[model samples]
Target: MISFKKQLLLSMIYTFILVLLFQSTALSCTTLIVTPGATIDGSMLVAHSDDNHLIDQRIIYVPAMDHQEGELRPVYCSAAAIDEFPQYASFFYPRINATDRGPGYNTPGFPQSIPLGYIPQVAHTYAYFDGSYGIMNENQLMFGECTDGAKVQLDPKPEKLIFYSSELSRVALERCKTAREAVELMGKLIDEYGYYGTGETLPVADPKEAWVMEMAPSPDETGGLWVAKKVPDGEIFVAANQFRIREIDPDDPDILFSSNLFEIAEKHGWWKAADGHLDWLKTVSLGEYNHPYYSLRRVWRLFSMVAPSREFSPWVEDGFTRDYPFSIQPDQKLSVRDVMMLMRDHYEGTEFDLTKGIAAGPFGNPSRCYGPNDGQGDVGNPNRELLGAWERPISVFYCGYSTICQGKADLPDPIGGILWVGLDKPSETLFIPFFAGVQSLPLSFSQVDTAQFSRDSAWWAFNFVSNWANLNYKAMRADIALMQDKYELKMLELLPVVQKTALEIYQSNPDLAREYLTNYSTQNAEFLVKEWWNFADQLIVRYDDGMFSEPKKMAQQVGYPQEWLDLTDWSQGPITYKKRN
Candidate 1:
């Protein structure tokens, strides 16, 4: 009774599901999804789960500041900012100096300044944004590049510009009465300090509105001397490992941020005059030829998804190269979903995808490397290899491993607004909402230690479901979808109860909110585990049926490709124009 088309669809779906299950356990790739709303749990918290031993722990990195008195001083600072009100404190591990008697290696007089700031003192002064695991700041203000070297640690520069340190950024909490004030303050600080950051985008985020500031290095400094400009409002932008700011909007302050972007390029002779105007993009990319691999590919991938009409190739070597642009503001207003999808995406459709069935071997996987043990799997191309071990392909662990809190005193009673969307393999993972207001995380959530197999952690939970689904794809896919549907409905059903309970506690006893959220998380984790196991078992049985004989199974496909349905489509669609060979 089953149609061939239906059977084919089911088969494909099964294959895709199996891939998810296999990959989930094979490595550590997780996506951190966040959503915001006003709640009693306070403002500005980073909440998520992770596989590393450093999970749920606060991180702080401080740098030495040279005082006008010619003395180097140490300052304590938060890894990130928690609340944008009353006080500015972060849940960062204060940097400690470690010293050893052995001459091999001794901790320096100071701990590492979480080492990614345009202004050094700002690392301690203002909470330099920490994206928990991968990205420190969500509004696209980030530092630290993914290179195959020991983690980088920057020290003080000879010419101290402004006290425009990251600590000075804390001034936003002190001086800026409003968001507009904060923007103006940032601009002034950049003007004074020279905006020295080694990130793709600039740091621009408050609790309400966020902006991306992209910078380009000056030609004289071997890509060292730099200036940054802010991204415009109403448009969503993201920068991953490469510069993203593009175009000069002289008319709109909300749409751009360039520190003498035009004047400096022309004044310094870095940019050639074009029709009496300096060509910014051309000048930036003159010496830098690896733009696609270094940066633009991510932009093309993201923009291609939200607006598929644009034509850009992730693999092809176009005239474009590095120093391409600092920002690329699209012509449309980006929605929350668009931003979320962009953040969670990988190089799936592009030639860079290690898993791309087509042209994968030919083009090579940018996400891979030559491993010490070649037996682990395929080794990446030598020309462009990614650093592996301790690094994730997409680094989703940060999304689930850290807790978002504003300040220790202002911690939300029941921080319930945690959102974790397992983009690459979300179906296998259950995004349990945890609140900073809670007293303790479940023992299982905290049980992560070595990278070995264990079901007591969030990583393992994903591993469990994904591993089983991998063995049998089609049946697992349907089962996983069904479970997700039920889980979503249950969440919808429970949200009201949770909200009402939170309100009641807020009125009667404020501290009780944490208890409610804590209990809710523990119970939710247990119940979801049960659901995952049950659904996984159901697939085990159905997948054993292998052959497509059942009519009920055949009817599930609704004329769509099973593989395409579950993807977090960052691209709009297939290009309408045929390739001209």
Candidate 2:
């Protein structure tokens, strides 16, 4: 047994670890929503990044099921689902004990039979794609979530709080078909069953329209308070772990909310009649969760890039600043590819650009290694954690996976809805299409054990290439870009044919269409993933020991940039001998 003093020290360390782990998945995500009118092809799009260290990079298919009249839908302890997906264990010890990445790292898998509780079930549930959160469903209803900061963060309690944003999203996909239907159902469930976990903003979209719904737990933790506003057609919305919905009309049809939204605010002294309508951020959110500019910079950069003419100042007070609009209309209509390009941003060419500083080193790498004292005030110390926060860019290197959900009104659901998935970092990943109608996903997407590296994992394939490029990013990136474009462009070129063939087959036999899509999707994923491993190997051989090598051509030495070398303090190093002139 441990001594009391030692136990106390261990307790403190455990608490600190818990906070870090929560912030990793909860506060680091970024979201994007594009309405049909804003896109070139009139496709509603929702994109999300599961930006966390050691997050579950896999994507699975949750099949449609029909239940008995009295059958209840199990509400999973999503916070405790690490064993089922095997990702929760990767975050440390907060999840399924069997797969705990701790001392029990190699423990056998255990079934997730017990749930936090159960909710009223629907007779018929829809088939959908599942990732870190429930993704798109068979009906083209899709969602993307960003967990933000709030006044109260609660763990899922047995009877009081049973739902998290992840479960809410999965349930919505399991039952709903329209954007309005999903928002209304989630708000009702939160009010009746209660909600837990950090504040969240989910970008919900269908072929017809797109909307963002924001939710936060009530001060008393009695239930959840919420509000949602539809993204006006012709506009694009971005959610970066902060509440962007402001004053609620309460009367507008587009704005939906929990009944107690105003009452809870007033009761908690977060709102007043004389103070005017309720402000979601002022009343519920704790401003920016992490550090200043962590969330806002991402929002500002995305908006400014799409609508360059309507520029917004990058400098904002915090996540609550009104400088950035809730959504903006792009000057030009965007394509699916254009949206993909936008998500790969690093705040380049702006003052806040992550690649230009001395901190980026000689290779101009934009990836910032996260330190513990990032959000907390940095005390001047030799410890690296106290060195202050880095600029959190839209394209994060730590991202487990990122997705773009495209729901088209013109085509059938099978051919129309596509989940464009990219493993690892958005900057380096080649987006692969996964059709909503596919019966199964490629085994590589969900078969990995994150505790160790496996060549069979598609995530590892992209992850290997990305982590390798960090060493000589400025040089090796050219080859990475070539590999990415070679396959990605090829896929884009074949998309028309695949859709046309799939649609024709879908008209006659829906099952065959699904099989065809599954084969195509699986083949593309497997083929590219295989090639990617070779790509990684080539990068090592070509850039070996900081030299650029090629067939026939002699190996050429690569050195540091003149600008980086000039910035160095020569006197800090041993004296260098120079030829006397």
Q: What residue runs in model 2 are displaced by over 4 Å at the alpha carbon?
A: 1-26, 80-108, 111-113, 377-387, 569-581
Residue 250, candidate 1: how far off, in angstroms?
A: 6.5
How well does each candidate superpose onto the true structure, as a TM-score?
Answer: 0.49, 0.90
RMSD of each: 15.0, 5.4
Q: Per-residue CA lDDT of candidate 2, range 1-581, in tens?
A: 88755753564466457545444433468999989999988999999988864445667777777778997776656542221222222232222222211122222443322466678888888888877778899889999888777777676666678777778888899889899999999988898889887788999989988889998777788789889999999999998878889988877888888888888888888888898777888888667756667788888889998999997888876556899888999999998888778888898898878888798889989988755545442111113243467888988987888999999998899889999998988989889998888877777886655656998899889888899998898787777778778888888789889999999999999999989988988898888888988888988888888778888765788888888988996435656576433
Q: Write the per-residue lDDT of candidate 1 for residues 1-581, one digit (tens) a residue.
A: 98755753564465345334332212121211111232223222222223222222222221111234332233223222111111211222221222210111123322333222233222222212222232222121222221110011122232432222233334443233233455565556545544322222234444444444334433333222223344333333434433343445556555544456566577666654474443334444431112223334544565566445455545545434432233343445443323333443445555555334321222222223323422221111224443432122342322333222222122222333333323123334544444334444455543432224655545455555655655444345456656665675567467657767776786778767756766886678667766665665555555453433234664232232334443534244565576534
The clash numbers for all candidates, in the given order, read: 48, 0
- lDDT, candidate 2, at 422: 88
Residue 196, candidate 2: C-alpha displacement in angstroms: 0.5
Model 1 whole-model lDDT (C-alpha atoms): 0.37
What TM-score does structure 2 among the candidates reach?
0.90
Model 1: residues >4 Å from true position, as ranges? Answer: 1-197, 202-208, 215-234, 248-251, 255-298, 308-418, 421-428, 434-447, 450-453, 463-485, 492-497, 500-581
